[model samples]
Target: MGKLTATFLKEIILLARDRSGILVLFLMPAVLVVVVSLVQENVLKTAGETGIRVLFIDHDRQSTGQVIEELLSGSGAVEIVKDVDGHEIDEETARTLLAKGDFQFCIIIPKGVTDGVKKRVEQQITEALNAGNEAQNEPVPLPSLAVYFDPLVQGAFRASVVNVLHRVVLSMEMEMKARALSNMIPVRMNLILQEIMGPNLINVPVGIFPRMDSKWGSERLLDVKIEPASRGGVEELPTSVQQNVPAWALFGMFFIVVPLGGSLIREKQDGTMLRLLTLPVPHVTLLSGKVIAYVLVCTVQFSIILLVGRFVLPIWGMPVLEMGSSPAAIVLVVVSAALAAAGYGVMLGTIFRTYEQASMFGPVSVVIAAAVGGVMVPVYVMPEFMQKISNYSPLAWGLNALIDIFVRQGGIRSVLPEILYLLSFFAGAMLIAWGVFIRRGRTGG
Candidate 1:
């Protein structure tokens, strides 16, 4: 314990003396988080302003088709474009517009839609009455509402648009049914009264149907309810802050490889490693102390970056960090992530032979990993192949874990898989580094 403490203090003192390392470890990540957050916020705001574009082609040109068009045109979330250059678009033209990125989706309301829906509703009610069963019979087929979408559009957004169209069609169907029921009541009631009282007994013909209660008379054939994924009681943070803070922080943590590896190379080249081996401290203890010191440094780095996101950025008129339900889970992620990064640094330090090699390659490799791991761009926005490959980056694991805690409002169990992966990376790198050190000792190199 005493020797480990001594070695730990020695490493801290040495690292503290290096001003450049201190700046990189502390200041660089904070600056990056703020800058990236600002940029992402702006991008999101601009994208929100550009509402989803859709093409509406109405062959019906009747009341039903006109109703749908009116609903879509008035929607703030969707923009409906009907024509180009004072010419109406057909299905083929709509497809062309979609291909050209003029619209995200297309909807075609087929001809005779309003008349067909009215006919279908009449047939449904007549069939139900003839069968002496009010059990909901299947609705008659009407002209289909055809939807065509650009393959490039996101599946989730495309599905949302489809759902909106479905609701519109359903409402139209309901209106037709209500009208059919109203027309039936007077005829059906007169026939029953004539049969009971004998023909010409009353000498009066009924001309009106009594008003029916909407709630009891109207039974919706299709009811669609949408539930969002976010659970209650958990505050969702801004996308920019939730994503950028952890991503940039992970990038900075992994960059500790540059200084840590360079220091090792410097010691090995100057024969300081040989001198340390002769001292009373075991070689393993010496390595452990360096690892411990850097782990602390990484923790500090993580904390500073988070503070900037939570407190400092908000004052600058940017989004503030919204914490998750589990503070303990967040701390666990930070510690595990820091260990993984420090372990990687030690492995890099041992593998590289010179300070120049370590300094050049360590930061470059970290930057590449950061780019792939969603530090620069989100993984979801990347091509499918790139997203699959991003899983291999340890930094990706760390960033995902942090997001689960902070944005997803997940508990400790929710991020166990990511935590395990990070620990495995630490263990694997540390073992390889240990082997390299053992091989060097045996050869006196």
Candidate 2:
């Protein structure tokens, strides 16, 4: 027990004196969280979470055009720009801007759409109403809408925009058809009544007919209720800070492998490890001390990032980090991740004979692990094979557990699988290090 405590204190002192190691562990992730979160916030805005800027040139400048602008504005999905440089934007100018990628979308309402649509719709309804006759009404031409999009716009985004426009136009067309039918119904009824009793209907007032409203066609018959999918808990919306903080914190924590590996290499090269092996204490005790010291460093690293995310990030107009109700789960996850990281460090140190090899390999391997683990992008968004590959990364396990707690309002049980995976990885890595350490001792080179 005394040996273990002494070794732990020594490791801590060595780590404190290593300025480069301290910088790698602390400053890098702090800056990563702040910069990446702000950049992602802008990405969210571009995705229309806040709003997308759209160039709307309504050449028809009548009812259909006015209605399109009003409905788009009410939906709150886009910022409508009808004018550019103090002048009403023409179709040619809007097209030029879209092609240049200065604007993502441009909508043009073709001329005579309103009058043409109304005339065509009324004629179609009239023809349909008198279907028993010869049906001699000619087909009237209707103007189609033109929607120009930037070449770089994604297919999904274009589909979404097209869908919104389709719904709005369909609603307007249905209302127009309804109004035309309403007008024709009274006319047909009055003609029949007059033909049947010409003199008897002389004093009849027009007020006897039922009133029709344009809004009636737009009202939905059945409504859909949207509910959140949560574990019957208060649903927390994930913000950029919430995501990047945990992601890069895991990144920094795993980076402990660098210093841990370097420390091991230094001791081996200086004959300190050989001298320590001569002592009565088991090598596992020495490893335990290194693990404990680095785990404490990792915990502090996680805390600094949390504090920055909760307090400092919000000052930059970011959402406050809402750690879920389970603080115990968070602590457990951090410790498990730190242990896994330390074990990897010890393994690398045992295998490598020089600090340069350990330093280069340690950071590079961690970056590869982080890349596959959903640190930079969510696993679901990756290609199919990469998604399967991500399941094997320890960083993925830690990141998943943290995200579950941070956004899903999860508890200990919610992250049990990830915790177990991380702990298993720690155990596996240590065993490999032990095997390597014993083999080298017997060779006596």
Candidate 3:
């Protein structure tokens, strides 16, 4: 037992003395966590704030053009560019701006919009009289008619234009009704018609106009707040650790196993294992002690990363303990990850006859594992085929179990299946390593 303890302490001291290993295990994961969180935040912001800039070309010099400009300006959602020194805006220029992504939408009021409004007003009044409706009845709501804005703009922008059209059309309809009634009445009754067309009638539609709700505009951007399930509180932004820590920790833990496996191969090549065999110490005991030492190293590395994530990334104040309600679930993730690292180290040590072979191949294994385990890219974003392949990687099992505990707030019972799969992978790798070791012993190599 004393010899095994000495061996464990020796391995720990050796790892601590290696500055390059310490940086790879600790500092790299910490920096990567910050970078990934910032990138994700920027992506979400861009997607939400993407808006169209529109140019308005008004050919009508009449009050109708002024009315149109006023209506457009009322909507804070749109930026209407006006009074360019150029002649009428041609379709060619509009298409060119749209192609260059300068303008997503455009509006054009042709020279005869006022004449069209007058004709539309007369037709509306004729229809109202023919229907035999009482004058007291509310005027029919006008259908919105857009001039030339792209239909593919954000829903808020489209609704803004529609709302402006409704106001303008309603105002024209009220004016036409007043004129029609004045014509029908005798000179003595003209006073009554003029009195009926008071401010109330002209402005009723404006007051009841269906303005676009700002809340509805936000909904189009999918602005949803994600919060810790425990507090029921909301977060304006995702927690930094939530967005960044997993990938870095996973990749770091993976690389840490390489030096462990390489060290074992070196000891075997130097005949150190043969010298140790002269003692009464069992091989399994030595192996288990080595694994425990590596676990301590990995745990210290992970703890540092977690500390940096909490302080540097500062993803909300939700305590790490609040990641999951069950303490056992957290323990299970750590144990499973440690077991997987041990199994991989043992397999690499047994497969290679020399330190050179292990060093050459161990990094390749780590890279492949990182890629398939959603460490390089999230599993959610991977292609379906690649996602399916990820299920076969042991790192994926460990990461999935951790994500279930941290992100989903799952309990031990919820993560049992993942734990089982990870244990199975560890057992399989260990068995292969044992087989290789026994074969080499029989060959006397």
lDDT (C-alpha) at residue 11 in model 1 = 88
Candidate 1: the clashing residue pairs are none
Question: Candidate 1, 177: how far from true, in Å?
Answer: 1.4
lDDT of 2 by residue, 4-29 (tens): 99899999899888888688778888
Query: TM-score for each prediction?
Result: 0.65, 0.87, 0.60
lDDT of 1 by residue, 1-445 (tens): 9999988998899998998879867998899889888888865653553456678888988987788887666655567778878998888888888898877788888888878877787887677555755555667685688889888877767777777777676766666676676667667777777888998766346555575544433366677975435545554544788888888988888888888887777788888887887788777787888889999999999899988988999987777787678989888888888888888888988988888888888888888888898878889999999999899988899888888877777879999999899999999998999899878954446
How many steric overlaps are in each model, in order?
A: 0, 0, 1
**Best of the two (1, 2) by lDDT:** 2
Q: Which regions of candidate 3 are displaced past 4 Å?
A: 49-240, 315-322, 441-445
Superposed by TM-score, candidate 1 places the C-alpha of residue 25 at a distance from the truth, in angstroms, of: 7.5
Residue 144, candidate 3: alpha-carbon lDDT: 32
Evaluate all candidate structures by whole-model CA lDDT and list the values in order. 0.81, 0.87, 0.65
Candidate 2, poorest ten consecutive residues by summed lDDT: 436-445
Candidate with better TM-score, 1 vs 2: 2
